[model samples]
Target: MTPGTRKSALLAGTILSLSMLAGVASAETTVTMWTFLDPNKTSPREVALKQMIADFEAANPDIKVKVEPQDFAQMPTKFFLGHQTGGNPDIVWIDAKNLSGLDTSGAGANLDELLINQWPQEDKDDYYAKASFDAAMFGGVHTALPLFNGGSMIYYRKDLLKEAGIDPASLTTWDAILEAAKKLTKDNDNDGRVDVWGFGMPLAPLKTESSPVYISLLEQPAALYTGECEIKLSSDLGVKGITYTADLITKHKVTPQDALVINVDDVTDQFIAGRYAISIGSMLRYSVIKGKAAFGADNFDIIKWPSWTGEKPGATPLSGWWVAAWKNSPHLPEAGKFLNYMLGKEGVGLWTTVGGQVPTRKSVLESPDFAGPQYDWVRLMVDAWGQTGYMDPPSCNTRTLQGALNEATARVVLDNLDPVEALKEAEAKFADAQ
Candidate 1:
């Protein structure tokens, strides 16, 4: 071949290569996500998320996800604050308690409009339940997708209940629970002191444990929300719930009196030490209790909250981090696609199998991956989500609400204040906080 022809062909090849690279770069889109978890971290959730992101990227080479880790408690507040400066993230992770505030902020995107409008009802029905989507729904629109599921339940000694001839199902009512507690409470050495308190509940306002317990075990606190940020917990129904909780420590003597000062951590310690038959706790603590229990790890299992009547189980506060997109994000379409990918059946299924989270999809929960004895806790939690009611977080100050309730409980059980009086004080404090 002639030198001139060879040189012309080489020049044309170089130009074509440069043009292709430019096309690829121009088509690529980057989506930024804000979360408390660093994908580089080795935690199970982080690891699973990291792998999921990598998988998404591999499947869609035109898009890249940029994760920006933020402090969890501050993420929600910071997200709104950033909106003021026009520097909001493309996507954000929000805690459930603060989710109501998201609607008023006007920064959250309408996920139903962006993603779910075209989805068939069969696909929509695949979600765990109405609450699964309702938690993210605001003013008749979905603003986010539930990323994980968490709820508090009573962790009990399986062996102790069997020895006492108490079927866990029989303790479905508070009255039945009280009777079972009476039987379970005993002194092993014939001492006049109880070696095992039938139940342990953390009532200290200084700790957040008791407040979660109070919310998880009943729906009244959420029911009292006036929709205008006012909570009338001083009402007759509210007073009744508080009275029952206090009587367990003050009158029935089934729960340890020391619960007034101890938190859930302390209660958990006492439980593992075999000084309590049942305690208010979380699934996150299940593995720890199982590994550390003095009596036997296999003896520990969970029970859903009992109701005032045996008609229904008390609501569990079933919420975890939620995934949302900025309403005015420049990359709204791309962000919506990423959110769908992250929350899709395969994605959440991978999360349950690898991240060790409770699956949020009914199909995933029933899948073969969840089979076997090791996943009994997962099944129990699935029932907790399916069979019982759930606590709805208020749009107002959740911490303040919890504080007021905790203080009211402390006053009744510790200072001997009247339940109505304490409830009134709580109502005033909560009103002032809002």
Candidate 2:
């Protein structure tokens, strides 16, 4: 079938499945769920989520579910507007990066009461403790429940690395990465043009603002709010991380000079098209590369981010979609019931499979079903996340602060400004945002 035809068929199938199971809503129970993921991606995790929802509907005939999907970039504004109009979803999927902002705004329901009263102790125990803890205590109140979790992993084209004579296994530090990048980078065609870039990473402030690069590197406990309204990105460690990223382009010349101009989609496209040997971002790139780019799993591989000596090995920032009820949601009890169903064993398994996302449930992570090529790296990623991960802190003005850091990093890398000076300027701007 043509690509368009296949896409249409997939959509039709999803709609049919949802319709078949959406039984009549009880007068008191209508659970509305809004998320930032597109439903048509056909990622394993997404497919499983659909199935889980259908199963939930089948079992709970009295509670109807309404799903509204939005793009990631548009979610923040929509969430705020929903808060203002008190028309938000009963369950909303939020990124960890936005937790601080949500906490400050008091837009979400505190899940503590629900957890204590509704969730089984075993079910609560099944979740990764840190994720569960983080979700439960935003500003000392349980604000959300972990849905899907993921962390960054280094993505490389093995064929390209072999041609460059670089041992992928030996890449354990930024210096080694730079050396490999140099070898992989070359004018493949003799037409006075470089055919492949050694590395490609998002650097545009506007684009990388939400990309999770800096958060991964700094390993700060929280970037925006310290729960008491203090900004922490102006620290020495933060400066070091920012400088290291800048050096990839300015000093090492490993990445594309115009990397700052590219967004996440552009970087992913270039990597899939074999325009770069290495790309750094979420491990879910495996699913995208496999399904969307039509590449086999064996064609690419992943590694943890290279380490910085004397300090703990840094991994990419950990973040994911979380389920939370809006403070004004009328269907609280049903929303709570749907949440329990979604996080249950079957739901967890289906969501992890279809979404191509890691399960937040420790039971699911350790289950025999999770053992496979597609999920092996998830284990490694989870281990690394536990060791080196940092969550965004609760801040009264998180988005603004994040924007400032993005601008500071961009100026240093793209505009060739001094790193220290740029960061100092960023710190000042961050302070002003308060």
Candidate 3:
């Protein structure tokens, strides 16, 4: 079965099982949660989260929080299936891109009334406007609360750029990046083969949905659809983005010719090993790789992705998970209390520091403690958030459309297919699928 189908089945089973357990919770109120992050990791977030849950349990002696870790890749399908089956968890993590799908599925509970009635105006104003707005409405109903806000940035090796004699400050456009890449690409072993690549990107089909290639190419002012039922990849901006990606491999030869097969982990590995000078990734990516990668923090620095038309460079798309309560959840009041606590000052601060994720709250962003060397990129990201776009297409059949897009990209870059013909065929397939 496809991954989506398998997730749907798992969620259906979970819902049925939970329904039977619901009746036995009279003595203790248990709030079930589904999340993508693995708590077993040695990251600060993992440690803090465990402590947070323990503290929550201590404070709310009558309630217990039971977490069910799920595969991130299957979260959307499982969430929809559980909602349809009346077995959704009290709280779950949801990707921003799936807002439209959740709204159409009628799976999420409207939280606007709760927010207005319960939260203070000061608390409401703390959140970033865009993050708050995206979570507030799904199919015209407020459904979820923003958790962590994130945006993409360019992570480059400073030493490598200096060695190439390229001024990092001047590398603000696609043309400049290509020129730097040429200078950076080198073979130190005196072999004919080039050992170092100019750039690294996550091109593996496994991570195609959240890959940087898509963000670099398709996410822009005119490329994304804000509605729940439109596809806008045929626009001039979209084409420009795609052509630029093709050019990186075919025209400029900066990125590896086989990049389409390299996953994010592999890309990170290469960057750490000094195989590439530059990479595109989310802000949290640096934190995640800090101790794990060979390169120390001093070796790399973050910047905005290069612009195309001489306009100021824009950051990549801003997106992250949100927390939502199921409409039928018995512990609605308790869940709301926990959510509020999570969004409060202490909770947001702990979560942000541990997870290396930007806070949704403006107050947290403005905190004196948060204004540190670690958050410089985050500030730049927020400043450029308006220029970024969410990564979802409006059509319900997005998976099929995405598959066609990936295939078209692979054909043009790897198979030597004509770009014009490949794009035309891909568009035709997308239109037919929709």
Candidate 4:
């Protein structure tokens, strides 16, 4: 062949080789995820997720994960808008409270079938029988898989309790709790200002922190909601529950004058500053309590909520982040694999140890590390989880219902509105939502 012909043949071979390499590159699957966990931050959750992602890629070399972290408050709206506009991610981290609403809005791909069709029975056994698996199902359709389960606990200063001549062990009823609170409340420096309030109650207009506590106070809070999702916040029992809690601020004056404006963060900050003897919040606060507050397990501790006479103490309902695949995701298979990896033994192990989440699996929870001294407080949480009561009304409009409850609670505590009147307003709003 002539020189020109040989040069043309070489160019054609080069083109063919380049096309083959491009095909190989395109064969790799990419799964996009949207989450509130900021990978740039060195928080435990972020670190665990990064580790999980690295492990996932190592195991599945053909798949790649792309994480897009956004603000936690903005997630629900952004996910809803993305679903509406057809520009959604492959996977989303859903707030447990919003799972039903998002599932109803077509954001979640039905994962119930995966339990039967895709997942092996042995693999499924690792998850909690009802709390982890069934809790994710909305109307029998599995909307998501729990990233981890968490609930609030009341944290008390054991040192303060002893100083006030109150025994925490003897306080298992509302009456005893109130009496202890009275003792705990005092003006330490003789400045005529109450430096330490007995209890820190969250009553902010936007935060529904009081809702869980109020529910725990009820014998059966679910009785406040009908089968048709009609809220009966003005029921006699409901009134009594709200009245007793509101009295902590109004009648008893154990909480601050502006407790009506305090949210979870405010209460936590105050608790750390030694301004409150007792406060309620999530298990995530344990890190702060142990590290920043410099409080030993003896100085501070958590307990199940006090109950009415002859009733069992109640625990907060399951509340945490859940992961779900979007129905519109083009990479469903890859997304499913990623989710499975995150929920598997290795993923959950890293999360519990590093991410500081309560275990969703009984077996994992029973592990020796969880029973170790470092995580002894988790035993109380596990006990609480076992006895947790359901507070959320099963409705797609739960946010509306919760907002109504929050508004009514604020009115009763701040404006001194009658419990019946405040709750009637809340009932009207919930009925309107339905």
Listed in order, each prediction's TM-score against the native is 0.79, 0.83, 0.83, 0.88
Over 4 Å off, model 4: 1-27, 113-116, 129-132, 211-213, 288-291, 294-299
Clashes of each: 0, 11, 1, 0
Better of 3 and 4 by TM-score: 4
Cα-based lDDT for every prediction: 0.78, 0.70, 0.69, 0.74
Error of 2 at 100 (Å): 3.0
Q: In the order shown, what is each candidate's alpha-carbon RMSD?
A: 4.9, 10.1, 10.8, 3.1
How does residue 408 of candidate 3 score in lDDT? 68
Best by TM-score: 4
Q: Write the per-residue lDDT of candidate 3 for residues 43-122, one digit (tens) a residue.
A: 76666567667878888878888878888778877988988787788888776667666677777766765454577777
- Measured with C-alpha atoms, the lDDT of residue 325 in candidate 4 is 88
All candidates in order of TM-score, best leading: 4, 3, 2, 1
As a TM-score, model 4 comes out at: 0.88
Look at candidate 3 and tell me the lDDT of residue 93.
Answer: 78
Per-residue lDDT tens digits for candidate 2, residues 20-91, read 666322343668888755445466656666777778889987777777887877775678678988877888
lDDT score for candidate 1 against the true structure: 0.78
Better of 1 and 2 by lDDT: 1
